[model samples]
Target: MSLIEARQADPKRLIAGATGEWEIIIGMEVHAQISSRSKLFSGAATDFGAEPNDNVSLIDAAMPGMLPAINAECVRQAVRTGLGLRAKINLTSVFDRKNYFYPDLPQGYQISQFRQPVVGEGKILVSVGPDNKGRFEEVEIGIERLHLEQDAGKSLHDQHPTMSFVDLNRAGVALMEIVSRPDLRSSEEAKAYLTKLRMIVRYLGTCDGNMDEGSMRADVNVSVRRVGEPFGTRCEIKNVNSIRFVGQAIDYEARRHIAILEDGGTIAQETRLFDAAKGETRSMRSKEEAHDYRYFPDPDLLPLKFDQEFVDKLAADLPELPDEKKKRFIEALGLSAYDASILVSEKAVADYFEALVAAQPDVEKDGKAAANWVINDLLGALNRSALPIEKSPIKPEQLSEIIRLIKTGVISGKIAKDVFEIIWQEGGDPQKIVAQRGLEQVTDNAAIEKAVENIMRANPDKVEQAKTKPGLAGWFVGQVMKATGDKVNPQTVNIVIKQKLNLED
Candidate 1:
């Protein structure tokens, strides 16, 4: 509603300067490459890992007579991304020339948007943190605008001992610059905002959101202010690729700003670079205002206008986003908010969970069970190995089979983990592994009774203590399970030990 009311500032996040406490205000300008086969205007290839200049065209190379043409697919993707963000879609938007001098930009002035953008103000609800109750606190990050622009080629300075190299392969590629309002207050909120933003774009299929390969990056604008004061002069941190680096840069820059301001120094508005290795932000150049760019309408491009039907068609084909999926997991699938949030954070993880549920004969009965194994076991194991869900050693059906085995009493939960390890190391059917390895749970009543009797008779001293301290029955359960090679259900052993020792409930 209001600016101060809209921002969710944590009192603890306030910085303690020499004089008083200060707050960090952050905004983000993220550049995401559109997942298209060709560049935004030229017909040049847009594939990554291409040879130097292999993907360039005459227009991309700034040949004398080459003209630029709009790529309709890039327009569609920007609109789709706009709808995904729940932002307003302006039917009529214009592209302007961003005049700048760079070694990588073949065109003297880059074509971009200034006043008119395809997507207008929107909001993203980001869930941050596990507070005291282990719950994510939801905060809304406002999107200012999203505009389409052409990417500049990459300049490789480390290719040789002294000489530099320029690769035009990335030139003329499509890019969507999404600008966020200065609503972020802390490093935690900044990381959560970036994470949520990346997830949304990945879900929309607009961008791959791969920060490593430079498919997505952010230029962080950071400023510091006293609690009730107006905004401070902001510095732009250019081209931070990783989320961890973003947090690091913000932390370093915020403290730098606070140290300067607290020492009776005014912050100079400038563009800076985050030195990830040094963990600091260094000045790149003085910040340029809109007037400095001397923005004018691009002579080559026409005003981008589309009908409402185009937007409606794209909206109808959208997939179920993370928020909707998380709600369904909680309401219909009986998953906890924490579990559902983790599962739906990534599309692949959610799909795997859904597949496990679908494979079960009883969805309601096995939903929580599936969640436990997935989150606690599967995801845990993957994280330990530094592997992704797509690269998991165990598939959904294989995990489903393990759950099914436990459900059908073929194996105990303890033994199921053993079976899981076997599958992880050596691929095999869970059912066959249980049967062939003699790992099935010993569910026979008579066999369990015999094992309990033998264990009790051999440990008379412990049995005497068990009569007074019934909790000693747990020792007997462990012995019996160990003698039975841990194949018996633990619940069954606990019951047999209780009955044998005459322990109270």
Candidate 2:
């Protein structure tokens, strides 16, 4: 069963029109840099950081007679990503020239796909919101097209005090421009869609999906119309770099459109810029049509065709996607839906979780405890440091060792946290740390009884109070555990406390 179906159903319907029960329409254009060694039409390096114009080639600079040659590896990666998304791959696809004049465009026109795209018509299932008793809401968003294109160079606007510089390191790089249909209605839906898309692309290894590095960016299109009325004029919010900003842009634009209609004004179609600092979208330029760019097929490149066997080969080698891995976590590993979803959201995180479980002695029996420890303890540490799983100081084996210590009563939960901090910062074997620090749990009956006896003798007034009010026994128990530096098992303390105070057996 689908995640939403397996759990209780939520309100899937959109907000009744904001303006007299109006409906909101939304779409997204995501540009993800292709993972390749070189530029699309040139042998120049596709590295992100280099001196200005260091990676530019003769063709990339748009020399008068320089000819363009297609990169086969780029095409293969694009097709691989398309197949991973369960998209329709067009056996025959063509490239067209989109004419636009800008300083960043070394060439007067950009080579892109217009009439025929590489892939079309796919869907992705995205989980929204925080974990609730191991449950979350899942929504299926539609993919309209995934096309191949060349990225323009960067224009450094604020590098110096006076004139701006241009960087061609990113020029002519391969990009997979994935466009989504206007099936989204709310900002939350938009955020979830972008997040899930990033996860899928990262797992496929087609793109790094680093928004901070500008390797991935999104353009949000929003419009609002009265209930049962035709679609309203939409505005495109361009080049939003982060997922949080995408939600803010949509919300701001939607409310702006609604207020305009309410004031008896017309909503004009245009392109706008998202001012992240102010959390608003301001108009950039009037909307343009396809004829405005004067698009035409590039004569330098011939029509491209792919063999059925080739597409099938890439499909066979496709890694397990987020949705597939999530299902396996729930069905095979017996993890809750929420835990499975969090673990599978990133490739590294999921791999780390699997490694930890495999290193345990009783994985099948104690998998739930292992999952909780890794998710709550290790992940919490990595998050505090602002580091990814790959950069964590604690390895999977070390984490498993700590969990085993707790399981066998060699250490209590409170002491384990302290040991974890030592291991995390000082870099020593957990066994050695436990041995040297003498942080072992006091599970022996004689040792625990001696400590509890001192507490009962010193606090007779409290002991007398416990006979009548059993809850008061908790105070003496805390004193004893604190005296032992939290090395005593909490369950054992409760049993000894009841026995000493003459409460329940």
Candidate 3:
């Protein structure tokens, strides 16, 4: 069944309690680090894994009389990402000071966007559930706004016995806080929405979208209410990195809220932390309102302004996005929705598939075969070795050659697998491996006929049984294949055996 069909069959993920069913409402604020070399308002390096304070500049450290200067590249990246999302590009936006106190924050106030943001009112279409693999029932999640802000540093509490160390390497780095409206109804939809957003930022060359390395993170807001009632008090789950953890946190939080509301208890408006180890959310502190931040325009920096032509140029330079590429793969390459979706899930995988198709000009003939090899064989080997697609040992040209050998009947599917392994380990031409290893398929009609004859002669009783029970022909085929060392063409063997046994008609 399709994902939409499955969802329709069982609509609500209701919480069973004494009163009745409860509905969950969800929204997300995703913080994506811009893919730039330097920090937002400083010249410090933005490289990950740097030693503590090694990359911090005077501006990053907020030294005396150090003024913040905006990074033009960061601004361009933010604009490019906005255009990719089909968001409204405000020609003018303002940066404000968000007052907060933390040890890792060198500046007492964080420079961020409040009243005005660069990107406004966008939407992302996401598909949820395993059954919706290729065919997406798109749910349009509304994007409230995308604003620019500076990232704070890290605090290390486990390094010392009593004293904690602060690392300012990430301080003053540019972050795009993409806020979404409370359109997500389930954890599944929230996960899909995050996946879609990550793809867009990565494709735009704005964010790396590496959740493990903290390049991107999500603050999930979850609440529960009785059916047809008002929204409940929401709790914010902060900095859930992994997509699986995001879904889990939401599910746990929604149920927690429902339990409180049903037991004559009021849910608290607070910020919580997702404990991945325990699979539960613990309260960090009470959630603060906008007024609590004391937000005001920063006097050090001027308002950001640009012209329409600047936005147009950035839009023009965007590569074909995931949606566009997926449609092209389906329409032009004749691939199923599932196959196309898998291919386009990652840019590297999609590029490799395209290169393989380009290597062999007969894409119309070999496209589906190439896709199968990539998704099944190539990806399986890579996963087994725990290697990314970019580090794959088998080149696209080599894979294309392997597919061609199978299509041209030079090698059977089984033999091609052996060739693929050899190319992966030893690194040589697929055809050369086949030729040198004597892996060529045996298509000699007479030799196959003799093998079939010998098999039938040896297993006369089985052949007699086959004459009565036509399904027993498979035994003869398997015996012939084993006798020929599994190198014989299976189709030819089947045809010759059927002719000998008079099973053809």
TM-score of candidate 2 relative to the true fold: 0.93
Reference-based lDDT, each prediction: 0.90, 0.85, 0.88
TM-score of each: 0.96, 0.93, 0.95
Superposition error at 23 for model 2 (Å): 3.0
- Model 2 residue 469 lDDT score: 92
Instruction: Give the residue spans of candidate 1 off by over 4 A.
Output: 1-9, 363-365, 384-386
Per-residue lDDT of model 2, residues 1-505, tens digit only: 0111111212453444434566667889999999899988889888776778999999899989998899999999899888878899999999999999888898989999888888877887877776455557777777888888899998998989999888878879999999887777678889999999999989999999999888899988898765556667889999999999999999899889888888888999899999999999999999887899998999998888988999999999999999999898888788888888889888999999989888888643466777797789889999999998998899988888888899889999888889889989988788789989899999899999999999889888988888999998788778988999998998898898998877866
User: What does candidate 3's lDDT look like per residue over 1-505, in tens digits?
Assistant: 0011112212445666678787778889999999999999998999998878899999888899999999999999999988887889999999999999999998998999998998987878786655634455668877888999999999999999989999999899999999988888888899999998998888787999999999999999998877666677899999999999999999999888877888899999999999999999999999999899999999999999999999999888899998899899989888887888889888889999999999985633577888899999999999999999999999999998998888888898888998999889989999888898898989889888999999988888988888989888887888887887778888888888889999996
TM-score of candidate 1 against the unseen true structure: 0.96
Q: Relative to the unseen true structure, what is the C-alpha lDDT of residue 232 in candidate 1, on a scale of 0 to 100?
A: 86
Q: How many angstroms is residue 189 displaced in model 1 relative to the true structure, after the best TM-score fit?
A: 0.8
Q: lDDT-based ranking, best first?
A: 1, 3, 2
* lDDT winner, 2 or 3: 3
